[model samples]
Target: MTDSITISVDAMGGDHAPRAVIHGADLALRERKNIRFIFHGRKEQIDPLLDEFPKLKPASTVRHCEAVIAMDEKPSQALRKGKNVSSMWMAIQAVKDGEADVAISGGNTGALMAMATFCLRPMEGISRPGIAAIWPTLRSDIIVLDMGATIGADARQLVDYAILGSALARSLFDAESPTVGLLNVGTEEVKGLDYIKEAGKILQQASGAGFTYHGFVEGDDIGKGTVDVVVTEGFVGNIALKTAEGTARQVASYLRTALKANWVSMLGAFFASSALNALRRKMDPRTVNGGVFMGLNGIVIKSHGGTDEVGYKSALGLAYEMARSRLIDKIGDTMQRFPVNTAPPELPSDSEAKSA
Candidate 1:
């Protein structure tokens, strides 16, 4: 394992702001002796919270900055205007300067993704840096990419996403030959868009790549863990992620209500308490709090904005795991061996570049 990994956190990023963020940092520092923290936010705002817990003061340090970028701000505008903003620039600068091994944030997703791309750039052949979120399944874990990073993707880009997703599964999950599946409306070859069908062929014929191409997987099959990695454009991937989350919440609610419906049912709950608790543990989102921004030069993790101390602590734990796994370097090496076909679109003339 790597010694003493340092993480720079955006103290003002989450829904709970400095309080939950600080608490999580303090908890992480206490639990992991080899980890250190750099809190990026205003000292005046964060110092009062630190004073409440004296023990953490000795181990962690803060880099004071005055401003913060709002969650609703546009990505390009925020990065261009908020140069001195604590949440946006400070965390990126820390990674760029090698002051921190990884930078974790729960800030505006758009702003965070844009700034990371602009500052760190992508691994040599990667067209776009994607966000990979691990989805829990009955059989094993499934890694999904481009959850919200890039919007529309061509056939070549989808193929590139599959390669990137495969590399992530190998490094993070230790799958010897990770299975790759393209997300589609149906499992058949003659389904969805032309891009999906064309991309499927490329993935199937691709040689020297370590991935096991499993063809197409439907949305319903995602929770079954039928494959190791699922590739899709950001639009479909984001909807899949949200739908899974919503469904989980609904199922948990129904289970709780059913268990408490009557005296006889309540008694049964006691007998099955261990099994019930285990099921809850497996389904809880808090257990896996951070989603990794893959294909970047350095590790950048984004935690849920609604996270509490426990969720935030899990994010820190993930950051440590990625660093020790040397995930970024592994992806870079893999890309070098089997380069992605699609390159990022070139910038057009100044007049043709405005958003539609």
Candidate 2:
């Protein structure tokens, strides 16, 4: 629906640089007729992969750069010292120059966030950009925000995250009035820390304006489908996400082993084949491969570092949907309506915030 949306991907950002990344670009081209990709990395690294998939020749283009920022490098140091780093710098430049609708990477999380914050900057009224991850719930998906972005946030920042998360749920999932819940240790109003208690009060008072503010939601309520949006600071949200992911994988593994243990169970597995397959599909991380960095001037999707072709393709699919949805403009307009009360905390002075 968008005017042939172009996505710029960091071809060498992940652990399986060039190969997996190029395969992903090829997959996106083959599947989406209107989408184009600008692969940023070394030509030597990507040329062979492109040669293997000739259909990618016309639909995609590559911008060659020499340097590479390693996975372990500190984000601030990388941004300053690695000026010519192919994936890092090119991805930023492409978005800034209006050459791409979105930029995606499966590289270092800190570096990617740092690059995005510097290159695109936050929207006019956004204090700091937040990351939103879609978690599977019983009834529907829950959109949780500030997932490792702003670690220790104030009451006002939490409220801002709630607004941003609520808008995302409304826009992306078409929830008329999304239920917003604050993640806390207990469901009681006065159970959480001082900051959380204060945030809950503010959210409860402002309920009728935007979303349905459900007082408190504990860790047990995450996948129970109790709330549509869960608002928490980055530290807790990240831990929650990682825990959910690990638990899902462990459950699947245990099921598989148990089913193959005995002849009786093997027979049961046959009868439940379709049901098990459905469950596996629902739980597959590849199906939900893209995570959006909200409150930014441009659309940015972060893929998993260990993603294969399937995950890569899914990211591109997400990018296409986000572009068609006009999410950037929608988010900008939303920020204009409900702005952050306080400005973001300033970055350390010695750290130079480079664009790419």
Candidate 3:
């Protein structure tokens, strides 16, 4: 933690590339002077932006990369065209090369995941790496994993995610034994798919090995922050994330409409502006921006491509906290305490299934 943390950034990956990314880094540096940046992107586009932030320019080292991965590109196509050359690829490469403590990108999700896996590879004993996101809940923030990194995990893979996520909870929340839960159809033992129930059974048996298993949690439990970490396969987790985001937006829209409906409502809103502002900040998805691609040898943060500089800055802050916490090492240590071999019968490895 004493040493400066180096963050490798894909400067040209986001919708507001170079500008948003560079500004975000600068803002992050203002708060945490111990950070250094290695920006990968077109020299022409990035250099001028860096020049605008004198402080950031001094702390940053830019590596010019001509190619950029389009936001809409397919994972396979992005890999074929961008591997070894794209800004996104180069940023992640910095982590693998030990030049950066972590890599951050506001790029294509699938491409970012693919490049990270192809370049950094999975950590030892991990079958598939998953993306973990910080979710703001009614009570407190919780960690949710498989944020669409790899879809459809087996029971053992789900257990792996629980360990990976609890490690993150430990790093971020400083919880000695973070509560972990399986996201399922219902709270009952036999309520979910066979694999989910199986995963729950293993977690119940292994409670206190590293984390406290909180049994099964339904979708409502997520917003309630019923557990410190919620474990699920990518497919369900991704849908849940999108749904929550959409609901937040919908609620905000409803509030705005109600406030503008009449003079009385508008006056009430003005009277409660401070409280409303606090609520807005709490509900903002941008405030919790980065998705940590866990189960990898190195840390990789994926930011929302359409986010502004403030949102990107939030992502950078997440990267800094994760690096400071030694998240990857924590995951490794937690995995040892909670072995997957002791779990239910294993399914074919994700890679083998993909290849077939």
lDDT of each: 0.82, 0.81, 0.90
Best of the candidates, lDDT: 3
TM-score of each: 0.91, 0.90, 0.95
Across 1-356, the per-residue lDDT of candidate 1 in tens digits comes to 34888888888898988899888888887788788888898889888988977777766788888878788999988788767565657887788889888999888899889888888888766777788898888888779887989998887677777777888788879986789999999998888898888778777766357788898999877888889999999988998899989989998999999999999999999999999999988887988888888877888999898989888998988898788777777676556655334333232224543542
lDDT of 3 by residue, 66-98 (tens): 999999999999999999999999999999999
lDDT of 2 by residue, 42-87 (tens): 9888887888988886777888878777888888987786555657
Off by over 4 Å in 1: 339-356
> How much does each candidate deviate from the true structure in C-alpha RMSD?
6.1, 6.6, 4.8
The better-scoring model by lDDT among 1 and 3 is 3
**Model 3 lDDT-worst window of ten:** 339-348
Looking at model 1, the pairs that clash are none
Candidates ranked, most accurate by TM-score first: 3, 1, 2
Where is the poorest 10-residue window by lDDT in model 1?
340-349
